[model samples]
Target: MNARDPSLPLQADELSGLADFAASAWDEEIVPALTDYIAIPAKSPMFDADWAKHGYIDRVTRDAAAWVESKKVAGLKLEVIRVEGRTPVIFFEVPATKSGSTDTICLYGHLDKQPEFSGWRSDLGPWTPKYENGLLYGRGGADDGYAVYAAITAILALDKQGIPRPRCVGIIESCEESGSSDLPIYIDMLRERLGNVSLVVCLDSGAGNYDQLWLTTSLRGMVSGVLKVEVLTEGIHSGDASGLVPSSFRILRQVLDRLEDSKTGRLLPDSFHCEVPAARVAQARATAAILQDEVWKRYPWSCGADGAFTLPTTTDPVEGLLNRTWRPTLSVTGVEGFPDLGNAGNVLRPYTAFKLSLRLPPLIDGNEASLKLKTLLEDNAPYNAKVTFVPDGRAGALGATGWNTPELSPWLDQALNEASNAHFGAPLGYIGQGGTIPLMSMLQKGFPKAQMMVCGVLGPKSNAHGPNEFLHVPYGKRLTAAVAQVMAAHP
Candidate 1:
């Protein structure tokens, strides 16, 4: 359809007005708010032993609630809802216009962030917001802080134009970075308060590129556990025990070898067996076509003898995308047996442990997979070593089939296609994201009938949950405008 198409009612005037509003407000208003929002070190509750001690979470929540209140959208009520001692949740609503027209649209995002890991450039700090080369750099800038701004900005922009809106509820959580520990309790408490909702939007995902609007069709669930192997009572000098004693590290490696193929990076355990869905495979092919040249080059580090670890030359691009989005994967994230640099010595450690992080397919049962993984690892331990398995967290994967919401597919495709065509000269493509958004599953449980649209400003090389994290300001502004378009076009 052309830009002037009457059926898709987003006129050039409306688009220009929204884009202009976003550009001006983002620079003069959103940037300052984001700067202050990023300044607070509101680490997840899991990272901080006493989250309330520093008052960072509270401070950020209050700041977000204040921003929402300042919007003053007609018929919208904003407030911070607190449960017992858990982190506060900012809730705001734009009531529906007429009777039986109250179709609630709940928007979700988080205010808290993962612990800021080390290895940052000299100019960038975790809490300090720095704008450079069209990027806003800081901890919470991309992963979540932008959501609160984006949702409010979009709704308020529409309200400024006097567009009547559905009952839009924005729920910004304070513990999303920590697996949303207290969110369920908060949801239960406010279950009655939050009435029937028809649509949901989660802005905590990444876009494929700044030029295109990416919609995630599925999310892989995460299961984290510790694998421990005890081979001896105490460390022994390598000179004396090198030939006689079995190394705990070697035994740990053997057990891990059973679960993962060392050469192919494929999980060998049988418990994680779920075939990629047909629709996702098709989406992957499209994504591969779009990302052919940029995907490999986007890697931060150079590859070894195996090249860039991409799909085989013969493999279809669609298969490559399917592998990442719909398949299960495993990685050893941390080792407990490694010694500090200063304490390193030629000694065989008696006990070794490593943190195992497994990504389950969208249809796989996380708990069952975790149990199967533990059994496989323990059974594979060499030298009859003592083994222990400790599970840390598990979240079920989420998938949205077109069959569940047939009306949504075409709406999303059109909205995204229109937005992409306006910004870049191309149609927007869909893909599945590998990262876990714990709240998706939770929201589905609480609001089973809600149709969701998961889109965000994070793009390739944005590097969320890592040092030098940044948000593309211009792209973000455009993305917010796209969100406005999508909301306005919602049926």
Candidate 2:
């Protein structure tokens, strides 16, 4: 419907008051629900085939919506939208209080979590949420379970002070980790109800650090699938067929060689890369300068006997950052048909599978990239063997267009900076995150004119998608305050 403005601008005193409310809500409400959420193990559709059958995702969506409804905010409309077969989306709206306004703001997040990874320090586990030293260690907390709370906290915080804001609609789905395959369905079904969103806030992204607000300028696309190769009909004894069998693993390596160089660790084909935008390169250099040693130290580098491998021989952090964020890279994330060391035997295998995950530059095309990958790996197979590369996420293809920076209004920018400086004594940090958020491209296409403000608590040492992943408690509180401040100042 119509919207009215809050006091037009958020002041220093308002920020302090917002922070106080945020801290209290975080301690009394957010933490408890998030802890319970972590324990559920609501894995994405991609990771958990039984997600629908198990019903954990549905529980997460409904429980989360009910919790928000439990808050009893004024004019709040909440519901758990579920298609017959697709995953659920927690859809809700907070009607605008002010008059003569039609601007709608869409806030987004997801409930799905990545699978539990290895290596947890202290008494930590993926499903067991532990609060220690201002950090909540668990999966999905920072990578994004906090978004709905943050967005609602902002709205409620503003509402508590009688500050009016634009009508806010939120959609937190259960399929983000699975390339957001189900999200577009929700978007399409609710397109008319969503209205013309003037601004969008995504709290599922990366940050340089916890010192201040960080805005993601661009996101690299991703192409992932399983590459399987088969040779003989069955496993053969090494003594009987070692020489003549031509190991299947060797053939798999040959297929990979067509895509990447095993020696220098570079993508071999030119089809996978694109020229980095000059401004992005400059931004990378600036971000590198700001982060300094943090650019490399953020990673958990190993120190083995002969000294751990050097970080790919970059002359400076800027080159390393650009190479990582704006360049296409290939990583073999998983493998099959190989036994563990203790279970190993002197035997040749019939087939081998390498799980392929390739990151694409912002300007590259994922559809074209996947086609090239399938062609390179499957065509002209070593011995005309059965090999397949399947893109297993959404639309029969795990492809996403890279998102460019959206234009931000001056008022919005001012709100973000003021919020950052007030909540965190440091200025806002602007950087490009290397990870993929499956919905960025879709949202940009749908809301072509909306100003996208991507912020999150996934800072250094948060270890998202890895072991010991955590949510910085204080940072989340402040992030909520920031969102509130932005909401208060929305045009």
Candidate 3:
């Protein structure tokens, strides 16, 4: 049997000690630690000019590293690792117990957050952490801040029970919210320092609901660019330009109309290629069976009591879920040419630009998609307008398949099932998240043979990256217990 297999069985006393440790450590300590962590406003570099100057990121990283070190688990040493021009990654490890008996397991998470957008309800702020109605509220509470606490709590609980831990390394990066631009450089620098790892546990993703354990089977890649259209050299009176010259705004709208079907919110011109994988469709069907009602209820608007969208026929809940997670989607995130209230005028603006963010399917090639999109936009320019497509960012999707570790899956499933049953009074379902985790792809490339398991606590309506983002405290505690159970099961 492999070291992480819980089926091997723990002695009665060991199990009892673990249960007790989980109750004290997680209930009293870890939850509070997460609360404190959520208070830091370590927005991603794109969102903040003072990410380094404010020192919030550095402060939080050091605080987390110190907390891990204070645990003092036997054979475990904690340290902060930094590479020039990149954010610091907090690294800690519990050394292997005996030759050929223990294998290293890596845990990954991030500490950065997206800028808080407007439209929040009263009593919510970007940085201030709040707790209300069983949820812990803040920006980074769910997206990633909780992972470091969860990793430490799980390992420490095992140590308290005197169980030998598999050699484990916990890596917490600080810039994921900015698309993890610095990750590649940091990985190259630590390539030699980080040795062979058998399995990786990424604790930064979403759950289908409070009752389910979600695994991201595939992630859609993303490409973002700005589409600019220019007609006149300078602004002109609308009265003069109306009949003589085409309005730049009207022309810009015409160009965009060809790219998407506004009435249906679907992409047009057939530029994107996305086919839902058979496995992903099947998984979504299974998830929909249990979560359909909850999913509908979470939406701000409901279609009567059924909450179904208007289609010719009834839409399958599974298909709706699949569309978001596995298919390609495009959205115009921002417009640069439009003026605010005070700048209102009757003159036709000479230039207009809009930011387009496209989410590509797992099988789609990011570069190819970017090039095709650019060609389409340039070729379709109206009135012989000066059109330009400036690439912003691109990341290819990562597919999670194969490399199933003999030691991890069964234990994780069992522990998660037991915890879900106890907390939500139901069986936990597995689902895939639509969001991207660039680190997972990086790790897979570095450790080609490593088995990977991705799971986390965010659920529907958690509003991660949106206002009023929160971490459910009760759910988080239960998740911590589940992690402890997995550790006890691990050899």
Top candidate when judged by TM-score against the true structure: 2
Please write out the lDDT profile of model 1 over residues 1-491, one tens digit for every residue.
11222234667778777788878888988888999988889998867868898999999888888877787767678778887778899888777532345577788899998887888789898998999988999998888898988898888766666444566788889887666767777778777767887678889888777767777778777677788999788888989998778888788778878878888778886657577666667767778888875654554764568786644423555555666667777777778877999999999888999887787777666666766776787774566789887777423322211111113556656776787676555677687777777778767766776777887777878888888899889988888887777776665
Q: After superposition, how far is residue 366 of candidate 2 from its true place, in Å?
A: 2.2
Model 1 off-target regions past 4 Å?
1-8, 97-100, 303-316, 379-381, 394-409, 422-425
What ranges in model 3 sit over 4 Å off?
A: 1-7, 10-23, 97-99, 232-234, 243-245, 269-271, 302-315, 394-425, 488-491
lDDT tens readout by residue for model 3, 1-491:
12444445555565556556665775677667767777787877766767778888888898788777777777777778777556788877777543354567788899888887776778877677877887878888888798888888777766655555567788899988666767777678767657777677888887887764555566666667788888888888887777777776677778777667777667775546566667677778888887775655564543555777534212567767766666667778788877887997988888889888777666666667777777877885777888888776523322111111122356566655664555456776767566777677668768876766677888878888888888877677666655655544443
Provide the TM-score for each candidate, comma-separated: 0.89, 0.96, 0.86
- Model 2: per-residue Cα lDDT over 302-417, one tens digit each: 77688974564464788778777787788888898899999889788888998888988876777778787888889988877788898866755557656777766798778888
Most accurate candidate by lDDT: 2
Give each model's whole-structure lDDT. 0.75, 0.84, 0.70
**Error of model 1, residue 334, in angstroms:** 2.0
What are the clashing pairs of model 1?
285-318
Mark the 10 consecutive residues where model 2 has the least summed lDDT. 1-10
RMSD of 2: 1.9
Instruction: For candidate 2, list the clashing residue pairs, or say none.
Output: 3-101, 4-98
